[model samples]
Target: MSTTALIYEGDWVSGTSQLDEKFIGYVESMNRSGGLKVRVTQCDREDAVGTSVEAALAKVRKLPDYTPSAPEELKDLIELSLATHDKEWFDELSARLAAPQAAAEQDEEKRYRFTPYQSRLYRIAE
Candidate 1:
């Protein structure tokens, strides 16, 4: 799956409103194509930005394993993380994304690296 990271700054309401518009369009297109059903989850900014690493890790540990319904959902997750501009959150997400690729390449004895999606994400996150 391909992911593009977009960076933009504005008042919170306007910025998020624009994101919402694009997200709705994407979801509608997926629905029209009879693609995988997308489930949107909303988190408060405080929860997203203010949670401690330990608390966040604990919450993630308690959650069920993810099973993405479609490739698009993964792309959405990357894009959403980029939009937040939170370094810790972005780093954690990038590490999670790199894990599978690193595992797959371990036999080659090469360093683990970002896929293009993650590279773009890292660029924007910085």
Candidate 2:
């Protein structure tokens, strides 16, 4: 069976509430910062296991604002959480997140150096 893994970082809450001011703000921030990378693996199965990552995301979106962070259409998220705790899977996910930082450093090191303007009076003798 093919299985798709969608990886994202956040404490998924069941429902929206203002009672816990701190948690509400945190979750809202996560919702706004949508940089989470979802790596979907195509699984060969019929149930939720076979559902595409896109489908899983859609399900999450449909959840009511009051749903708790535990279940509430979080089957896919739960799977991701479990996978993240697995040594092998967590290592892979960590690598994926680190790639961009490494790439940025490499790009900085290879950046172009600006040359002085080729003005007639300021031209350097060859």
- Best of the candidates, lDDT: 2
Please give the lDDT score for candidate 2. Answer: 0.35
lDDT of 1 at 17: 18
| Alpha-carbon deviation at 84 in model 2, angstroms | 6.3
Worst 10 residues of 2 by lDDT: 19-28
Clash counts for all predictions: 0, 19
- The reply for model 1, stretches above 4 Å from the true place, is 1-72, 110-126
Q: Tens digit of lDDT per residue, candidate 1, span 1-126? A: 211111111101111211221111011112222222222233334332321111111111112235553445655666787898766766666666777777778956655556678666334554
Strongest candidate by TM-score? 1
Question: What is each predicted model's overall lDDT from 0 to 1?
Answer: 0.34, 0.35
Tens-place lDDT per residue, model 2, 18-125, is: 221111111222233332122222223223222212222222221223432333234444458576677665455555556667988988876754446533356588
